[model samples]
Target: MNYSKLLFLFLICVLQSCTSQTKINGVSFVAAGIPVTDKHVNPVVQVNANYATVMPFGFIKDLKHPEIIHNTDRQWFGESREGVKQYANSLEAKGIRIMIKPQIWVWRGEFTGYIKMETEDDWKKLEATYSSFILEYADLAQEINADIFCIGTELEQFVANRPEYWNALILEIKKIYKGKLTYAANWDEFKRTPFWSQLDYIGVDAYFPVSDSKTPTVEECLLGWEVHKPIIKEVSDKHKKPILFTEYGYRSVDYAGKEPWKSERSMNIVNLEAQNNTTKALFETFWKEDWFAGGFIWKWFIEHDTVGGENDSQFTPQNKPVEMIIKSHFEEQK
Candidate 1:
């Protein structure tokens, strides 16, 4: 080829590489009692969301208990294996991609991160039980052609105490699931996770406290990200993996940015403006970045009409002013 022709091809290659990355404008699609149909899933498409996470949950009695409960009679429709398959099919039909995310919930809102055993034998038992829960879903993920399979979520101390178990678990999961892999590390714990290199994306439940002000302005929230953005980027750089916010959002309440991770019921005033500005700050700061792989908003219910309103002080941007902001940004990303 002539020099000018070769140069033209080189520029085309660079541009394609730069524009090929898809911003994963996603929602943590909440499980509901009834089977999800096209009606339940259309809003995700309406918002221009190309991705949605299907999170099946495992539960233990408490932080110390090794025995885990999953796919049992007490669970909701979307938490069972068949439910996941149904939900995933509906999403796929709509042309939305899937991320089968299996997370563990400790009883009584106990943090999964604090789970540790009193003895090695018990730890072994816990690992065995947890592996069954995850691996079963891994098979389903592969069967459903999920785009990604999350190995775990926010299990900090478990990972810290048993990194070897986690490494083995990842290999086992990769053996069964034929797709990308990620772990939803808590914001404070992602830096210490030892297995980012084994996964396709560096996943963080990035509820970083960005601002402390009551109903802080967008500029204030943006300033808060300045402190954290570089730190998060450094980890992605070290791992040579794009950063994916497995879960990231702000509650529609006063001081929403102060403790973005906390979800306990609060009597604080509902500040729609705070949630709107804080959420917009997130999209503005991270959505355009080349290294940031994009994010799933913390929560989105299947039913759109009655979920969130001005009076509700919840994490969901559903039906609120912030919803439009999310829609606009997602539209642009597509």
Candidate 2:
């Protein structure tokens, strides 16, 4: 080929790469051991989620102990490396950029953000073990050409207390991996995180409550976002890093907007409209913001084709009115 033709082709490739990284329309695929079919993949693409977050779990029994870094033996706790590779490949095949987000699931259902260590020795051990766990996936992320790698997720206590450990971890991950990096900080903890300057993006698991209504209107949800958005923008400006809602969404139940982050609430009514409207409000509020880099809706399942419907109460916005809201918003972005 002539030099000019080669230059044009090179420019095309550069443009494609730029768009892939900057476009943050995304969704979180459930960490299922088995691969999901085209039926599962098609919807995300249809919704214009150019990115997908794959969360495979790592287990730490106690804050005083090191993480148990076993990918194969314990099937119930997390997706295997093989499973992650398969799912990542599947997403890439459908033109989706992948973010390999490995999260810690503590035994006895304790929140990872609440983990506490009493001694320096325990902290050191936790850092070393967690580094090994993160580096293993760092290698996998490099091999798969994944777009981003979240070094840690919602380990609020550790991150707040041990800035040196996280800084070292980010440096180590950069040595071996060539993708963007971010940490998924819980809604209340992002401002307190001290390591944002070392990473590519500020990631928030944005489950901030927008309202307390059993049946919230889109305007009400927008009001909730209005109250919270200034803080998000201020953080982005302080660090000069774009923000990604690494995880966001609500359960399809009554009063979802009241506590978007809650795992369970006393009210049990299956209010699909509440879920759908809250989602619509959030998109309308955030999608146009220049500093907002988009988000991954909390989750989707591989075991089943759909998670949200008339009768369901979980966070997946699939197979319901919320799904259409997602689809329309994403399509508009494209």
Candidate 3:
């Protein structure tokens, strides 16, 4: 072979190898656990250190009348905003990618029974209320330099009926916020949502029942991913998008009969062994799935000031053994 031709062929091989190694979008494909800087590569595996604290935003409306129950005031906005910023900064300081979720659920206490957007006027009011809240939250996220911002969560009924409204809202958000965008959809109707193609990544609340019988054992809870994995893959294949477990949590409430064992006014704390076992099982099953971008735990705190009823112990990770598991998982990733 000619010397010039040999050199040209070698260069072509090098280019091909580089191209093959690279991934599309902002994710990077990795065999071992290694961080990839190039946005074009997709990560083979990643774990989320989710703090799940957004109810602070609802407290915004209750600022003026602290006496008024469940009316989140405006002053609380600044306080909540700062709290979220501090939390995001703390997570990012640990070299973790933060997915900041700004909640937009109807204040049931304020709205009485059901909240719906049945008419144009109804939607307009809803839009104004939520749009303002989202804008403020987005600004906070930008201030904190969060990696991902979830625009909304579990408002499936409203989002499904109002696609154009959400699209406009998202476009407006994109103008001010430059991070990735996603909406946490309810598990039952996530695929039916009309705006899958409109967002940066697919986010889902993947909390399928561990067992229809009683609360399953830790091993059973871990194996729940086996059922969810295929469902997630199907959604990804259909949409050609990466998946994030935006919300998945098991209630720690112990049960007496079929119903949750409720004390006079409080939910029983979940068995510590059960919680640890479940967390380990989840990590074992989901740590290596290539299609998953990451996931956030169900929650860190409750919305109401006082912890009562099922909210008292259902899903909060406060003081749980799982906290250590999360720290170790993130440290390993780092």
Candidate that scores best on lDDT: 1
Q: Ten consecutive residues with minimal summed lDDT in candidate 3?
A: 22-31
lDDT of candidate 2 over 243-265, digit per residue (tens): 99999998899899987877764
lDDT (0 to 1) per candidate: 0.92, 0.84, 0.55
After superposition, the stretches of candidate 2 with alpha carbons farther than 4 Å from their true spots are: 1-22, 76-78, 265-267, 303-306
Per-model TM-score, in order, reads 0.96, 0.90, 0.68
Query: Judged by lDDT relative to the true structure, which candidate is superior, 1 or 2?
Result: 1
For model 3, the stretches where C-alpha displacement exceeds 4 angstroms are: 1-56, 59-79, 90-96, 108-114, 213-215, 255-266, 301-312
Q: What's the true lDDT of residue 200 in model 3?
A: 77
Q: What tens digits encode model 1's per-residue C-alpha lDDT throughout 175-264? A: 898899999999999999999999999999999999999988999999999999999999999999999999999999999999898888
Count of clashing pairs, candidate 3: 18
lDDT of 1: 0.92
Q: Which runs of model 1 end up more than 4 angstroms from their true locations?
A: 1-14, 17-19
